[model samples]
Target: MDKYPYTPGHRGIETSIAAAIDINPKLGRLQRVSEAAIRDAGTQGLTADELAAKLGQDRCSIQPRTSELKRLGIIIDSGLRRSNWTGKSAIVWIIAPMLNSGESPSQ
Candidate 1:
């Protein structure tokens, strides 16, 4: 990832992240990590920056995966937003509706 300073509520930042993930599908690990965190986060949901903090990663690292996971139908917006590192409100993500069981269906 290029070293770009994150500007709160900037459209460019999001666009760049999307572009990177689109180009590199090897970011699968991040997707799994993000999904697990979002599920573990439970109904309260967590913003990208909050998930990053919980995982001890950079916001850029967590944000892109969340975007990808949302696209993959693994997660969804909780219809909530909260302050991020820049003190700007950001959407919180929860696990997708189908994954609510906590345990896999086979378990």
Candidate 2:
């Protein structure tokens, strides 16, 4: 007789950790807003104000969300630099890919 073990759902510990990270209930809302902004950006990308407007959130909320997303490796910050407009620095951000095929889903 061969024995087989049952595997849990697609995500186990990761899901738990993500839930735990949301110590503040608003964190989830912020994350969703960030995700929506990223989705709206698509290949074009967006600035902080653009993201905030797209998500219907204030810059204060969007900034923290962007920081958290960057911490989670979901987004990359290109740092602030001069834009086409004078006296204005543009902070570019890029959304990272969810996963790499060769990389395992679990840590």
Candidate 3:
């Protein structure tokens, strides 16, 4: 996958993208690692920060992978938010409903 630097450059976006591109070969592995972590969290789900801590990775490394998974529809927002260390709220993510727990039954 190819990546371009984030526009409206401020401080380190260029270097960040460059590093990401340099690790392009590992993108799949990163995504899988992230996906598994989120899936394993089950119904409780996880925010990016929680995933990072669980995986022992930095937020920059884990957040982008989760964003990619979300964009690809592998996961969805669980309609919940949790506070981060700084007390700012972040979205909780879960496996896309159709992909988890089979179908609901009223029969």
Candidate 4:
């Protein structure tokens, strides 16, 4: 079993969370900003690139924040995908509804 509460083979979330804990204050702020951006986006959902653009930051910089938010159960994958800046499909994310907020990873 994986020791962390993250998907097997996925290091980005784990790494981001770890780095946020010790390396950067900006990342933690970005997570909060990203959360609001995603929530304000409504059902349309924003991809990492879109959020980055809106936040006046680099896409790569904000992508990890999204991953961390997802891991924390604060946001969720919306079962939809949209074209990113590179024209490749990217998963759309939305804030987890209030009812789902209390649910744990196992639920």
Every model's TM-score:
0.70, 0.57, 0.78, 0.71
> Candidate 3 — number of clashing residue pairs?
0
State how far residue 52 of model 3 sits from its true place (Å): 0.5
| Worst ten in a row by lDDT for model 3 | 1-10
Which parts of model 1 are misplaced by more than 4 Å? 1-26, 101-107
Q: lDDT tens digits, residues 6-61, model 1?
A: 11123468786566645354465666787788888899998998899988888866
Candidate 3 to truth, TM: 0.78
lDDT of 1: 0.73
1-107 in candidate 4: lDDT tens per residue? Answer: 23222222234697865654553546557788988999899889899988999999988678877777787788889999999988999999998876245555446
How accurate locally is residue 35 in candidate 2, as Cα lDDT from 0 to 100?
A: 63
Which digits, one per residue and each the tens of the lDDT, describe model 2 over residues 1-107? Answer: 11111111122488654643443557666676676667556656666766777777777556666666666666665454435233477676667654322332233
lDDT of 3 at 91: 91
Return the lDDT, model 1, position 86: 83
**Model 4 lDDT, residue 12, Cα:** 68
Could you list the CA RMSD of all candidates, in the order they appear?
Answer: 7.8, 11.2, 6.1, 5.4
Residue-wise lDDT of candidate 3 within 1-107, one digit each (tens)? 23321211123688865876666776787788988989899989999999999999888777877777877677889999999778999999998876675643211
Provide the lowest-lDDT 10-residue window in model 4.
1-10
RMSD of 4: 5.4
- Candidate 4 global lDDT: 0.75
Residue ranges of candidate 4 with Cα displaced over 4 Å? 1-23, 99-107
What is the C-alpha RMSD, rounded to one decimal, of candidate 1?
7.8
